[model samples]
Target: MEEDTDFRIRFSSLCFITDHVGFHGTIKSSPSDFVVIEIDEQGQLVNKASDEPIYKVNKMLPEPNNLAKKTKLDRQNLSFEERSNQELSTLAGCSDGDQIHAPGSEKEDTIKDGTSEGEEGNIDVLGSLLDEKTDELLSQFACDVKERWDSKTELIGPSPEFSLGRILDKNQRTILHSAIRQKFPFLVTIGKNSEIVVKPNLEYKELCHLVSEEEAFEFFKYLDAKKENSKFTFKPDVNKDHRKAIHHFINKKFGNLVETKSFPEPNYSADNPSVVITVRFREKAHKHRKRSLLECQERKVIYTAFTLRKENLEMFEAVGFLAIKLGVIPSDFSYAGLKDKKAITYQTMVVRKVTPERLKNIEKEIEKKRMNVFNIRSVDDSLRLGQLKGNHFDIVIRNLKNQINDSANLRERILEAVENVKNKGFVNYYGPQRFGMGRKVHTDQIGLALLKSEMVKAVKLFLTPEDLDDPVNRAKKYFLQTEDAKGTLSLMPEFKVRERALLESLHRFGMTEEGCIQAWFSFPHSMRIFYVHAYSSKIWNEAVSYRLVTYGSEVVEGDLVCLDEDIDDEHLPSSKVHLVTEEEESANTYAIRQVVLPVLGYNIQYPKNKVGKWYQEVLNRDGLQTCRFKIPTLKLNIPGCYRKILKHPCNLSYQLIEDHDIDVMKEGSYIDEATLSLLISFDLDASCYATVCLREIMKHDF
Candidate 1:
């Protein structure tokens, strides 16, 4: 039980088996007994086999070549006793039955007496042996990832069942959990209070190792602290459950509005619905533009709304590409908010000083890229940031697995959930989409870098390709990793023309830190600002979640609550952050109907209460200050804004489609063994997310 000084075992300890594809078979002996091979620059083993590298971390391995092999050969020529003491070293995982023989040695590859190489005459027998469970445990550890070619040959084939083996970071335990859910979907119910099946006979050492504890007592203590019990056959979800209470409160508060209404039979699943979104403006009376070819357009600012379906293009990127085709800079076009790149988005955008004819040409170019399924109509005024009322969402959630119960009960449960949302609004937490989607670099990291004035790091993070499968972009990132700016620029593809421009700036301005900051300006101002705003959104969401957990559903005396519905923006309430006076507190008029939270900024005056204190703690945890939001050097400081701590969709409605055609679904598509699906449609004020509402229903299931 003493601390194992085995380097290989220590390396394995740093990895998780459920996260990767290691040696698939069971192994009982220490990894030190196996011949470890070094990997070459090409990510291949330096051996006669010339196999691909498997381990992700083995920095201690010698450089890939025949030098280590020659050294081993030289040692082997010594007496049998000398050869037995010096075993060959190579980098590979070995199961119990697997064999690792020296390239030229005539001896059999077996572990006798716990020693790797045995004496020529007789090997001593050691009582230390690996059990079947321990062997299985050794195989699951994610000590290494194989190269693409090797994975196809040595492990699971390409496109392996659920993309389960790929582990991105050590903090990520969810991938393994996700794989378990995918395999046992029926046993898992996702949401706050989600549950999963637990195997009762798991080994004590396995559990201890998984929990990163050395002692069985400590491991059981950790499990007990988490309230895990062996008698409990299923793991229950422990998240907050306020839906029923909220529904009850809404019935009492808004009695008549809680009436049941019949809904039309939906044609799509709420998950994989064909979305039809239209951006609504703050100004209802805003006039549409007419053709004015006779005179130069007086309105230099042009606002346009366009609908795009499954275009797989970012709103700004598409518009910016169109602008380039029209011989204009990307910055010429501006939008209030970015829309989903993979959905049918009808969004509004602004372009400065463009004729209606020119706008049509730009639209035509965009249409060509979007498979000609789009509509771009120019309006009179430019769309200002935060100028939209809200977006109207027509979303379909697909593959409704609700047929286990009677149809009536399923329908009732869905209707009840929808009704609760319509009346009691759920927590207005920022959806995960607020953060970058599928990007290697997180939005918060870039924002923190900028706040800390690490301009070069921020620039590299933004430009570097995250997904290594993308060979072209991967090559571009490789240059950045090697600090070869010129090479990166030369290899940068046309799709990354913007990144190439930034790289060119780096090459021209010199590779100094200041040069990198100047080059960062090459990216669109909107995109750069979005990174900073992402941090703000994260802070706001965290604060709201903290407030909900701390104060529960009721408002305390010092809480910042919403005043009235007269405020157009439900999220950004017109009511100020007010401290509840004794009179208002006693009257219960200022009770927590809705809370307002701050997005960190220089101008944002955080509430002088517990909520404000949480905000400060969040900032302090990251070594950031509110005052740092004003980055004068970069001229990119953002004044803070307030966001609602809770939001309810206006005119909430939904239709559950029973036995809907599984084939009709194209977006958010999922395989539905169940014939039924759901179609949910709702409207929310600008800056609110429909997905947040859906999260209230689906929870972690989404």
Candidate 2:
């Protein structure tokens, strides 16, 4: 393959690890072709279901209410007859013993005018029909009904049923039925021969059979018991919708205290399977069992950690989708590092104040977006950037372009290249992703302008468009030509978040230098840091290239190297790096791979050699000095650190195959007999670019 001049000058990837003959192949033909899995600090691989002992919890708990206390007090104070009259009048939607009257309509007032002569005669007859024993019995029944309603304990049993025994007179029975209907709207009355039977209505019966909020807490307590028999099983006979409602109710009310599992009962049909819900205390809940329910709620878990596996989606896009579905902002989530947008990547993500169940609930939704989440568990803290040991890659390169006809010869060449990378490593240049692609101006240009305090230039560079055809570019053009923020925003696409945000701010704050600066600063901290970080990365890449070209991968005097004790597997802080002395270089204490380069910052130390001098020269060319990194107005400071100049792919291996090997060919398609594919797998340290390693093996730019 020929060299790419743009790649060399732009990205500063000037050299390769080996001059071995290589083959050409296409990458990312499909999302699955490039797989990346994160390795955590504990050296454990993060994959689907790889993490153990998942700690599950409900999304939220039922909020506490004082209804029970208020009901109890009211019941104690009011007599049965008076409470019944009040309740009946309430059910009838009228004042006690008064007919519902239309406002502003003239009618005979029962209370103000006193009872009419005809009403008095009917009242007299009804009073004569009633007896003291019957009235006493009815009042006792009302008391029982009130007690049962207040307790709310008979959730899984039969409905509250009572029999009005053997009424001999039909007028008395008819009057009794009317009274029962008025007093207890929740109950239904039936005439069984000479007897009257009263039971709760079907709707009320269904509600009673389902779990209540108070009963959920009781079930939680029962499961939380330390005894051997701590468990609760709910076997309700209901249709599919009712069963689903029961499940949702239990999950919402129980919270994190209990775990519920449902199974289809034996001899049940698929259309409407009888669900048996088994509830037990989660293993972690036992520690908080002694605490009160309020205390437990107050001490609910803080963070939920899970594996997020996404295909062909950028980190921000994936997080944004999740935030919308999970009812949270994107900032609520944190991951160790961003993965490739065109790969099937798996990494650990931690979310604040989220339950494992909430994360699990979105699995179907995320899966529809070609992503998935699993191995959900509660954690005490969030994952920070650079928290992982490394990343594992499984890459397949297809449609190889090579002159070799023999498969054996191609395999031998691929093995040689793989061995070269494993032994000598490759130049550690930041990938193209660090620098925004296909833009009219590079991100580093904006960063340099900011460092030099050229606010207007930086704003112009940010708003300028690469082309006028696209919607976002047209918006940018409109804004630049007319300074019409609203009109520009009208032309802008919603997905161009940063562009739209700047336009929105300009619309409100006016299109002035001060307004632009304020709008720029209003961006999220991560986004604000991104441009400057890209500038630092560009400087580091150039420095690494210069170091390799001049010294040829040898440890030189005045080069900075991290002490063994202070060297971190994940990151190298500036404080740990030490300048190589003449004696240290003479003794050859540090290898070429151990040398580090600074990513220009105010607090970092420069090399004591010519390479260090080159760093200042590069910054000077951009009208930037290291001290300018400290922006007091923005409350921004870059305390950058050292990075290794070389990285070797660990456990590297490769295989060569043809299209027919995987049995993915179409019946009528033609096969390229001359072209073969390469499959490689390896692990890279955190912050290391796998594409750079591949560049060494293939001698091709990504």
Candidate 3:
């Protein structure tokens, strides 16, 4: 192993998300399950790893048979709702349509479900009763109307009348299949043999009905409470059949629990009922925190993780909150909670209306404290603290009062503290602001206010894209136009209307050059094709591709040729070390990745910008038509990696493309922002070590 000259070439730089946005399963593409590749200085290939060549390795499960449908599998079972199909004369299946939940606006937008707005409580009486023949009841059902904004599309919008899916990621597919094994639950099936399959034609909102908090809570609360008391303590108050159905749903959704029983007193009631109720069940039976994390996003989402550095302390929440405070996060933003001010912590956070840079700038402008911004990453609307399902933390503690607390005592205390925090939930302590040395306001009060504010921001993500960590990644993904890659599937007709619109909204707040665009996300790329008014026009109709189109003037593609055009002289294509090989050459041929994105006649290219002036030149040469951009950069000599000895000379001229393969996304969906953060793979590792060695991560004892 040591014999290999280049480690980067020899070993893989594995990025484990430990968290990310939900799978775009229905799109028939997932970032996970693909392969990996590494590039060199001139954008040459340094290494490659193809995880899976044949996409959709697991085909969709086959349709169930009458005799086969009768018996459910062991790890899976049908909900009582499906069992009622027995009374139906015919199995009224679903139709072909997109699965869309009506979207709600920020101020007073309401979800367009059969359930009532504001009064989600009355859903029990307002929504139609579950029936085997969904075609019948859905025909009569209408979603509740409420005040809403015309801002943008939404997630929980009115459920699509019809939609079908091919088995994509086996993980999510299995979740859906296990939820309802019998009758086709939304046509999603997991065979008794564990294959994920879908029916061609489908019926109405049965899947939505399964996760609907209203019906789920009603049955499970009763079952959970009864199980807690004694045996067979069945009650007839809440329809017996309904009780069984709820029990079954809970088992599937929350995993299996101890002998199920109905709650003696329902969380919902006749008087004033709460729209949201936190039910208590045996902890052992609990599951779905990860699956349901995204569901709770409508409630509020926040993330907090950190990276340590000596000369600088990275406070992720502070940066995120400051961005929102400055009004960038128009929708809203928040942290799961705050961290100790002295510690260097890097974490992902969400807000309804903040830009990534505004978040990064908070750290940038604060050089007065001998601290500088190390680096920060972004997440989608679905990214939150607990929502991450897991966390990757890098911290440093300093100025320890060794005499005040011994290592043994401190260790004991930290472990106990962690256990207590997890069990009872943190103190909800107000962040540094509570005491930011301001007359000592009660921490709880300030913390409560932050919580409320964060929730407001979280609920607002519903109006926009589910996630956006790598702005550069977004442009590259969209621009690369490699439809073959699963990540680019968003370009498909089904997603264009919504996903594209969201990208445009983001572009309005960021910058782009050619097919390569950069946001505060900070993606690392050796070279980028340049374009003016790239998203709107077709200037590079033959040269380079446009990353964004709605706001762009063109989609252009071209070679990242040498900077032949000296600012001193107007001639381009100079002593440029032409990347195109003799066999693959045509003075840099541009391919139209997506006809939707224009390939403009843009020709500005650079391995990396030496100064902001280069960007200004693109703008000057192209005028205002040239978009503005911001990117974080780290200049480190990466150890060269190896590639299998095959193929022609390494073509380092690799243009950025959307990671469309499932293998690339398996760890988690890599959004533009997420990808950009990866660019900072090497930066001040020495400083990071210094902080940790000094014990600077500890907080000021309250």
TM-score per model over all chains: 0.53, 0.61, 0.18
Tens digits of per-residue lDDT, candidate 3, 466-536, equal 22545433533454343222243344333132233223323322223211111211211110111111111
Tell me how far candidate 1 lies from the true structure as C-alpha RMSD in angstroms: 33.6
Give the alpha-carbon lDDT of every model. 0.45, 0.64, 0.26
Q: How many Å off is the CA of 255 in candidate 1?
A: 67
The TM-score of predicted model 3 comes to: 0.18
Task: Show where candidate 2 strays beyond 4 Å.
Answer: 1-8, 50-301, 403-409, 663-673
Tens-digit lDDT string for candidate 2 (1-702): 112122224643476646777666688899899999999878778894755623344445432232113222122122111122222222111222222211111122112111222324434543455466754565566567656666864635764556767777765655554444434434445555657666644333334567653454334224222234357776555465566566544433332334466667786786666777776643442452478877786566467888889998877777767765765545567888878888999999988656777678779878988888888877767777788888999999987765355344555566677788788888777777666654567777777666666666776778887755888787787777888887988998865656765676565456777666655643545566677777788788888888888877678898998776436534576557889988988888889878888887777888899998998887776666545587654446887888888778888877665666654434445446465677889998888888788888877665
User: Model 1 — TM-score against the truth?
Assistant: 0.53
Please give the distance, in angstroms, between residue 284's alpha carbon in candidate 2 and its true position after superposition: 33
Query: Residue 490 in candidate 1 has what lDDT?
Result: 61
| Top of the candidates by TM-score | 2
